[model samples]
Target: MSLSTKSPKTSPIKIMQNRIYELLKQGKRIDGRAPHEVRPVSISTSVIEKADGSAMVSMGGTKILTGIKVETGTPYSDRPNEGVFTVNAELLPLASASFEPGPPDERAVELARIVDRCIRESRAIDLEKLVITEGEKVYMLYIDIYVLDYDGNYFDPAVLSAVAALATCKIPRYEMRNGKLERVEGESMKTPIRTIPVSVMIGVIQDRLLVDPSPMEERALDTSVILGYDSDSNIVSIQKNTPGLLSLNMMEQIIELGSKKAEELRSILVEAVGLGS
Candidate 1:
């Protein structure tokens, strides 16, 4: 007599995961984008008149607004000759159902830190040029980011908005008179920009990688990574989310893909801000 064997039944979740993987294998995503394709990006500068500089970035369904305020303050004790720079992010409750109205949770904090790292590590801003009186006084830049909509990949748009805002920032000139500093009316100078930093988010599912994953894609992803690169194609920052492990070969592939994407994003930023390449 021969024993009959039956295959184990596949769980619904597993079936769904398999479907996603299959689609990716065919070079297609649920949203009809290719594995390496990103969503359409739109950028608008000078959105907020009151702020020194401002920009709004929309990537697919995700929207982010960044505003910059410049003020004069004493330089840090250790870095007396350099100016101050701070980045803050807020995920409004209206942006997503998961967001709550209160102080920034871990997600918001992480978002701010990621953007800060990209700018700081890349040295995008010429901080020394912001110094007003060397160690005595210096320009303090406050970059505030707000999530107007949350679809999935907000990291790229947040960085784009912040960088665009900074690129268009106009700081009022100050002159020292009678042992006090006074702003020169009708006189302002553009923020000194050294380089532009662009960030790209990639999601890994099974053996395929997706660029600018949507909310559904994010939920199905095994892991995700964000890579920031300067205009010179040098990596400035890296952030990995989720617990999935990536092989050395996969990591190298990600870097190569990210560098090319970063260049494309940088060109968009430059054109949006009316800057020369």
Candidate 2:
């Protein structure tokens, strides 16, 4: 039941790991993907009617769902003019056997925080427009991420879902009525966005650099990286998981590899977000 402990299921993964390592040595992957090739990407928007916005993304075997909810609340004292954004991730037990039925464990929390850093720090949303009243009322974005299928590399897929949900989110109209903020019927605006950020994660095992590694492959990797980029190819955020020494040259290579992959993924999002629901 302990989320932090490695599951006994890992024993089966060990065999897979050895198989993948052998394949990597031959410049290939078990699934017949190139070392830097990512799996197929597909997305669907407005998946939930109750939420303001929702999106589902599937990357090969991994499936993730994200919902966007805008709430009216007081703004932070220091950031009176800006809205607030919180990202919450849930590892549903149905998604995998290792997941438990309780509060999010460390894995879930870390996934949420990393996705939050990628979106929030990238300044993807125009938070100022979310403010209804100075220091009094502001619209806050609640991003709920559900891991329906965690095959591998939750970081990148989580980011994809969040961005898609946000891009398709409708900003509801609210006003100060009777000294309280109330929603205005039949008045909704598009979510104000400043930039689009895309994230790419790759696992490094020995001399192999693999994009979108499978769960088995991740278990055998020496290290991994999750990096975010804006439309202009600027690095927005970066997270290096586990403790391992990486050469500067290797890091640079990974950055270049990640940046290219992010651009490819961005196009998919752009097309999906442009659709009319």
Counted clashes in each candidate structure: 0, 0
In order, candidate lDDTs are 0.88, 0.86
Best by lDDT: 1
After superposition, the stretches of candidate 2 with alpha carbons farther than 4 Å from their true spots are 1-18, 275-277
Clashing pairs in 2: none
Question: Which 10 residues in a row give candidate 2 its minimum summed lDDT?
Answer: 1-10
Write the residue-wise lDDT of candidate 2 on 155-178 in tens digits. Answer: 888899999999989878999998
Worst 10 residues of 1 by lDDT: 1-10
lDDT score, candidate 1, position 93: 80
Misplaced by over 4 Å in model 1 are 1-15
Question: TM-scores of all models?
Answer: 0.94, 0.93
